[model samples]
Target: MPRETLFTKIVAREIPADIVYEDDLCLAFRDIAPQAPTHVLVVPKEPVESIDSLTADHQELAGHMMLVCKKVAAAEGLSAGYRVVINNGKDGGQSVDHLHFHVLGGKSLKWPPG
Candidate 1:
């Protein structure tokens, strides 16, 4: 089995986080360092390394994460628009080992994101 990750620690309540949303399946929390006016992470409770690790059975989990992202965006007053980013691997800029969705809004995010 894989070792625990930062996100797993948070989910286990071993570390504190600025959690914004929580349900039976996942949780949404504010980013430690804000990238935009509003930046939060929508994460699944079940730690699956990254999107590359998901199987057919995990499809519902992925969809659920997206729905939670929308819910979090609205809750954060990002009615104008928002961006959901999933950094898959090293080349995709995934700093964390766990799969997570970045919900960013409250500003004009440029195209061709870094």
Candidate 2:
């Protein structure tokens, strides 16, 4: 219905990504314009614009994303701690239209997040 986002390109392998994790449910890869030392994006294979577009059928999908984030974060040696962020819309600072979660760690993260 709309033009594909950069993330969509990654999903289709039209663009290269430093993929950290992937499964039938979703895909996880390093952010090109990384905000933190350890910045990764976990995105669902089935396109959803944002969390606002999530429906009842997406509940399990959402949970799976979190579990994957957790496993990947630990694997990345961010066992100390990490932040999982979802920027839902333009005002929420979502640069990409695809629904994805940012996992940031490897340094102290100050709150009142920017």
Candidate 3:
């Protein structure tokens, strides 16, 4: 079985989070440390370790995550624009082991983010 992760706790409602959107497939919430005015983490209910852990069966789930990002961004009033980021591994800046999408917007984002 996959190891439990912080995101799994959030999904199970064991850990409190400022949730912004939720559905049967995924859930989205505010980031503890906001990198932008509108920064949210969209995570799947399934505990996939990271992007590196995705399989063919997760294709629909992955696509659903992107759609969740669009919906969350629009709901957050990021009409100007938004950025969807997925950190693949430790070097890619993925803190939580679960796969998630970071929806960032509310201002002009610079290119070549660190």
Candidates' C-alpha lDDT: 0.92, 0.93, 0.95
Candidate rank order under TM-score: 3, 1, 2
Q: Pick the candidate with the highest TM-score.
A: 3
| Number of clashes recorded per candidate | 0, 0, 0
The regions of model 2 sitting more than 4 angstroms off are none
lDDT of 2 at 20: 95
lDDT of 3 by residue, 1-114 (tens): 679999999999999999999999999999999999999999999999999899999999999999999999999999999999999888999999999999999999999898
Worst lDDT 10-window in candidate 2: 1-10
Question: Which candidate, 1 or 3, would have the higher TM-score against the true structure?
Answer: 3
Q: Write the per-residue lDDT of candidate 2 for residues 30-86, one digit (tens) a residue.
A: 999888899999999988889998999999999999999998899899988999999
Cα deviation in Å at residue 102, candidate 1? Answer: 0.2
Cα error of candidate 3 at position 7, Å: 0.6
Reference-based lDDT, residue 31, model 2: 92
- lDDT per residue for candidate 1 within 64-92, as digits (tens), equals 99999999998999999999999999999
